[model samples]
Target: MRSNVLGSAADFRRGGHSSRRPLDSHLAQLFMRDLRADAPPQLPIFRSRLQGELLARLLLGPDREHTMLDLAVMLRTDLGSVVREVDRLARAGLLTLRRTAAGRLASRDTATPLHEPLAQLVMHTFGPKAVVAEEFGALPGAAEIHLFGAWAERYSGVAGEPPGDVEVLVVGAVDPGAAFDAAQESAARLGLPVHPVVRTVGEWRDDTDPFLRQIRACSLVRAR
Candidate 1:
């Protein structure tokens, strides 16, 4: 089902618009308002990192549901902010809210025509942060993980073609083999190539290294 949605999104982007419907006027206006606000460097499509992370989690896996507390923990945000964003998205018709026995649960509104395209956009843009964080955060001796290169450039609002792959920098004592395995897993989950370059903490801190210096000059989205 996930693959189908992603494939459909790809096809939708390739002139497969006959079946696509326009967004509701009210929803469009709401989205426009959100977009007009200052966006985060990690995912410039949305006004804030919280918004991007929230939408990416809900939309990318529409079948799953999460409570406000669950979302807060997963997103590393406050409960108040999660509640506000959930309310806003729910009002926009992008998410559905319901009270369960445990608590209020939020999930993607699959009924919305915007689901597919929006999910695709999230998958390509903000997806790397979430996916990479999950995959590499637990690596032994990994002190810091960052995303750089084409994907980082686009995410930082540099206009260009969509990134074909994700570039990652792992700084710590983690084994190179472990980093490679994590990269492979992340690539599989994202449907894009993930290239991870492991550097020791000392190497990353060195300012004289041309490669490290160049990476520092560009946008680097921290994953862990």
Candidate 2:
């Protein structure tokens, strides 16, 4: 009887209790595959850089009101392009324009069921890798940079809440003052706190430290 119980346990561990697809709530491999198969494709949004970036910003801060000029300036794109893409997205029902007391504001349409899912997809794919690379690429003495914590987990498609902060691990003898200053500027732009943790290569390689071990266990996105 003990052997029989052990075998059943092993089956559950290796391939699940029967051959049927696991429940979605369980988050098993089969369940995740099924979820992906059932999900609507988001390839259209990614086809255009301007559209993709605009959607990302909208989803990132759904509550905030975005103007045509504001989005154009933030994305570093031309006004004409921003205006065209905004019209397209608005027509597609992904965004809505409101005549506010201050001016016109473009905001994500929360009423659509696609709002949450689309946001998750955009954030999972285009999270913070590009921004981090652009921010820290030219920093002196920074040999490598990695993104971990909530952002990394979301980027890897692990279901979680939107990241409230950006955490990066820099493996090199980088300047903390410079790192802090850069992080502050990045945080201001991103509307979230940017934290850069500096560590030597040797320190990073040493897995004996509890914090390092924990970092090693989670998903990481390499920026450099």
Against the true structure, whose lDDT is highest? 1
TM-scores, each model vs. reference: 0.49, 0.64
Tens-place lDDT per residue, model 2, 86-121, is 766777688899887776688889898888788777
Judged by whole-model lDDT over C-alpha atoms, candidate 1 comes out at 0.78
Each candidate's clash count: 0, 0
lDDT of each: 0.78, 0.71
Local accuracy of candidate 1 as per-residue lDDT tens digits, 66-141: 8999888777766766886798778778999999789899988989998867877886666987789889998999
> Candidate 2: where is the Cα deviation over 4 Å?
1-48, 61-63, 76-81, 110-121
Candidate 2 versus truth, CA RMSD in Å, comes to 17.6
Highest TM-score: which candidate?
A: 2
User: What is the RMSD of candidate 1?
Assistant: 14.8
List the lowest-lDDT window of 10 residues for candidate 2. 31-40
